[model samples]
Target: MNQPRPIFGTTIFDGSQARKGYALNRMCFSFNDAANRAAFKADEEGYMRSYALNEQQSAAVRGRDVLGLLAAGGNVYYLAKFAGILGLDVQDLGAQQTGMSKEEFKARLVRQNDQPAATAG
Candidate 1:
């Protein structure tokens, strides 16, 4: 059987690295100041809204649904644009979740959390 196609958000790679995975034209944003990060974290939606994206674009941010955005004819470029507008440091986010990429880590975390804990013998 054919393997499922990977999406843009599925794997965390630097803008340059991501290009190797067919994620070209994606923009990367970086914030060095902790205060800026905190501010962005405080209200990501508000920060994204400040970008002045149209109704469809606004829905994409509000949903946090990458696939939805893609389904709506948006590509990695647009999604990365959204990330930039929201003040997200894509490179940092990708770097923070190292080893096996962010998507793999997220899946692992979900699987580990869902499994029942082993009892001591």
Candidate 2:
């Protein structure tokens, strides 16, 4: 019998990368809100514009590519914020399997990584 390999599917970011994601999420959330949505609709580019972000930061948000954001400097906290803005409830998703909390899921990832790799015959 062979043991199954642990699977990881989520992207994780840290440091400045996380901060960028957080800031981007706040910006996106503001734009997506009903009241803001109306204003955004009136001036889409103006609303989408972010003053705090440099060219790379702006590019990261515009791309909407999480991995790209990380490559361009983003963190996990920011990623979580982005997920929230996108209406992706990480807590709910985490709880789906045995009611695990998001923190628990993150901890599990660490533990899983520490374990020896599984081999199949």
Query: TM-score for every candidate vs. truth?
Result: 0.33, 0.39
Candidate 1 regions exceeding 4 Å error are: 1-37, 71-121
Taking the tens digit of each residue's C-alpha lDDT, what string does model 2 give over 12-108? 4445545655555565546435776566447545654633555665675565555555555555354555555556565544543334666787788
Per-residue lDDT value at 92 in model 1: 30
Query: lDDT for every model?
Result: 0.49, 0.56
lDDT of 1 by residue, 45-75 (tens): 6654554444554464576545444443444
Clash tally for model 1 = 0
The 10-residue segment with the lowest total lDDT in model 1: 21-30
* Position 108, candidate 2: lDDT: 84
Show model 2 residue runs off by greater than 4 Å. 1-11, 70-121
What TM-score does model 1 achieve against the real structure?
A: 0.33
What is residue 104's positional error in candidate 2, in angstroms? 29
Worst 10 residues of 2 by lDDT: 90-99
